[model samples]
Target: MRTQLSIPVTALAVIALAACGAESGPGSGSGGGTVQPDVPVAGVHWTVDSLTVDGTRTEAPDGAHVEITDKGRARGNYGCNHFGADVSVEGDTVTVRPAEMTEMACGEKVQNFEDALRAALTGRLKAELTDGRLILTTEKGDSIALTSQQPAPLVGTKWVVNGLVLGDTAASLPAGAQDKAYLTFGKDGSVRGSLGCNRFTGTAEISEDSIAFGRLASTRKLCDGPEMDVERKLVKVLEGTATYELNHRSLTLTGPDGEGIAAVAAEIPGEK
Candidate 1:
């Protein structure tokens, strides 16, 4: 049995804010439950939901996908192979496992996924949504944390601002932000953006799973806009989500489907 611990209220708040897309860009959610790990449920579908172990950013398992039906029916492609899983959710408590997998081995990422799937099928979780995205948990605390395989950064090289990654979960926004408004991160401490409405600047730091973005002050006067407001939400929401991607030069971010968010990424200025 994986260790079970009370998740801090602050963390819950942060997770909620991150999933719900609030003014403060925080995360939110709650609850704890006793479970029989592999218990089966009748209606709700429990799916992959996320693929953080492979350093899921906006662009992850670039060629893979996960989809679940409303009745808890699910089917999708994991980057290297096909997979199927069964899930049961007791309010916030979730139990999931991949009932099917391709015989072909896919290295550590796939293997880790196999392990997490097994745990999720039996381990207990505290699940919810904050900042407009869904979060699933197993083992309550971080003891069962999966290692993220973040890609290399082409920073200072001008890759577009794709999206953020929090463990295997991703928060992406293209619908709310301008289709033309864009971004770039440099080797220096500066992070700049076009805002799709106006130019704005902020400081940034690239970490293993999180990107610290803030002091998001903008140009002198605000652009006459709803787009700006939309951009604001997108930026703030992105701050809490960790960042990741497939190709930085491509400036693309992708969100896992059903998570209620889209993946985001940027094209490298000079690259094709």
Candidate 2:
């Protein structure tokens, strides 16, 4: 199985914390017959819930998550930058080697949290799974809490464009247009959203792995240079059929020539 762990920190201040061992409370562990000690931990989207170190606990950020695969590979984001590591699972114990992390600069608070998380995840840890939750406890009693999450559906999801894909690389959107471009696909073969500066409505023919866009009508609006640039790129990709790859919460739409946009599922009100 190929596994990955993506960690992320939030705006929450990274205050000093402690090490509290994870106790298998009621309904946890394999003590009860209902608890399966050998549950498969691979290929599950484990959303980080919190981190308890020494004795203090901190809630995880929205995008904090981890996943492991059967291929001995672990990859994930640390709230800001992505990272990967080698891991081994034996019986109920999971051993995580020191991770190779990306050096993207983050805010002081997030950086501090990442440092602390990196330290806690290295070396051998006891793995416990029960009721769709997984806890990995380090030898020093530090533990990370995570819950399983179902993959987001493609339709009816608010996919906000986060980056532009060129060839095999993905680049961030212009600063001014960072969170402006978004799209929502409807069940009625309709698509609508802002192109960073203009609101566009169009017909989308959805196939098993591709989207054939029909005539897209957009409101005529003039915007700043950055916004216009974003709008142009988005329109180009949505002009024709594009292959799409959906990985958990992330989506990549690539046009025929290999240029496209990378989007992520946005949280919707009243939906989990």
Candidate 3:
């Protein structure tokens, strides 16, 4: 759910309230009002509960969400599309400015839900943090409700490729390629994966913001058609330095220049 910015009066009011120290509850002294604790929006993955547009209630489509990073980058699944944008938060006011998104087509119901979400998130919205929920309401009465949850870490996790970036577009693997590509990162800085045909292993350099793989060694197995093409591309991506973003059970790995891959967490044999 991403769009361009338009700060509404309600958002302005939130900024003013924060600036004036007009807390939501009573207190005294320099801290004359009881200040509500700031909601930890960054680093936490939020799952969508419901979306209301122009006073009409609508349920969020499956896998809908919005995640904001401390660095102001935002990424989410808007029911029918995957989007990334820049988000700024001042006081209780939050704004999402569009960047890039996948242009995948979907059914009418999903498209409608995505449209509503885009409208609600675009421009400036009044934000409220209560209990464990974060609500964003527009001046026009459109709103989105989300529940926060801890995100899964990338290190020492197994992931299976779901989609790959070709040039500027992202698309799912060709038919018959499902579950054939996967990668497992070890605590010892090693990574091993199946490239849909042969198994490969390599060392990886990981940091807070990026990852680069060292030389990789693989089995000499022959594959034809789509699987072979997938293997070649997957190995190329691994060989390049890629920036990664993780949200809950999903991971997106993009090269410094644009190419990348998207994957979902894979369950270990004994893990719950």
How do the residues 1-272 of candidate 3 rate in per-residue lDDT, one tens digit apiece?
23433212222223333443454434423545554534454455666778887677888764566665555466667644677765556766666665576676555666677666766767777776666676778777788787765555677667888677745566666767766898988879999989989999998888887889999999999988878888887887889687887768678788766877777766543456
Local distance difference test, each candidate: 0.41, 0.69, 0.68
Better of 1 and 3 by lDDT: 3
Query: How far in Å is the alpha carbon of 173 misplaced in model 1?
Result: 6.9
Choose the strongest candidate by lDDT: 2
Spell out the clash pairs found in candidate 3.
6-123
Going through the candidates in the order shown, the clash numbers are 49, 27, 1
- Please, what is the TM-score per model? 0.33, 0.69, 0.53
Model 1 TM-score is 0.33
Candidate 1 residue runs with Cα over 4 Å from true position: 1-154, 157-177, 224-226, 238-266, 269-272
Candidate 2's C-alpha runs over 4 A off are 1-40, 49-64, 76-84, 89-93, 98-119, 139-143, 174-176, 267-271
Q: For model 1, give the 10-residue run with minimal summed lDDT.
A: 1-10
Better candidate by TM-score, 1 or 2:
2
Report the C-alpha displacement of residue 127, candidate 2, in angstroms. 3.5
Return the top candidate by TM-score.
2
lDDT of each residue in 147-207, candidate 2, tens digit only: 7777778888899987788886656666677779999998999999999999999999999
